[model samples]
Target chain A: MYRVKVYVTLKPSLLDAQGKVVKGAAVNLGYDEVENVRIGKFIELSINENTKDVNTAVEELCSKLLANTVIENYKYEIEKE
Target chain B: MYRVKVYVTLKPSLLDAQGKVVKGAAVNLGYDEVENVRIGKFIELSINENTKDVNTAVEELCSKLLANTVIENYKYEIEKE
Candidate 1:
């Protein structure tokens, strides 16, 4: 099997409200050193060994279902299992 | 500055309803090669270079705010930036 790990993150130009909130909370909790924060999604998919073209399949999956292309960017790494 | 990347994932023993839903959708969308699907969170934090004991601070942050110890596990990597 192939284990595919995908990370979907907001576009660099966009403001990350959730990250801002978390950073604010962290400072309030006394973590003054903490600075800029960004939040994203991590997805793991297990693909069968016999599957052909794992790269193409995963790319399609990410563009179609795993990420919102307009506002986010996604990247994936595949590892043998 | 130190760039910290944190990944928070549900415990292996827990039922991930969101993952199940996504897996089902993938199957429905004809990505039959796809198997197990799991979802998690990815957080990036920047810490001042002057911060002392980054490891300890990050550990405390993970346990206290970034992750729910009862049902989730978190791991992080730090890099100089």
Candidate 2:
């Protein structure tokens, strides 16, 4: 099997409202050193080893279902299992 | 400055409904090689270098705000930027 770890994050150009809220809360909680924050999604997938072209399959999954390419960018790492 | 990357994931014992749904969708889309899927959150925080202890502050943030320790587990990496 192959283990794929994907990270989907919003483009730097876009505003991350959720991260902003978290940063505000962090500051309120007295973490005055916080400067900026960004939030993203992390997905892990287990795939059968027999699948042809594991890399391509994972790329398709990320672009088609895992990430909203218009606003978010995704990258993944594959490891043998 | 310091860049902290945090990943919050549901405990392995918990059911991941969202990931299950996505796996089903992937199958429907013809990527049957998928065996299992799990989803989590990835957060990035930029902190000032002057912070007394970046590690402790991030640990507190994860346990107190970023993660539901009862159901989720979190880990982080810190890099000087």
Best by the lDDT measure:
2
Instruction: Score residue A12 of candidate 1 by CA lDDT.
Output: 92
Model 1, A23-62: lDDT tens digits are 9999999999998899999999999989989999999999
Q: Which residue window of length 10 is worst by lDDT in model 2 chain A?
A: A28-37
Give the TM-score comparing model 1 with the true structure, all chains together.
0.98
| Residue range with the least summed lDDT across 10 consecutive positions in model 1 chain A | A43-52
The candidate maximizing DockQ is 2
Per-residue lDDT for B40 in model 1? Answer: 99
Q: Categorize the docking of model 1.
A: high
lDDT score for candidate 2 against the true structure:
0.96
DockQ for the candidates, in order: 0.90, 0.91
Residue-level lDDT of model 2, residues B1-81, one tens digit each, is 999999999999999999999999999999999999999999999999999888899999999999999999999999997
Model 2: per-residue lDDT, tens digit, A1-81?
Answer: 999999999999999999999999999999989999999999999999999899999999999999999999999999997
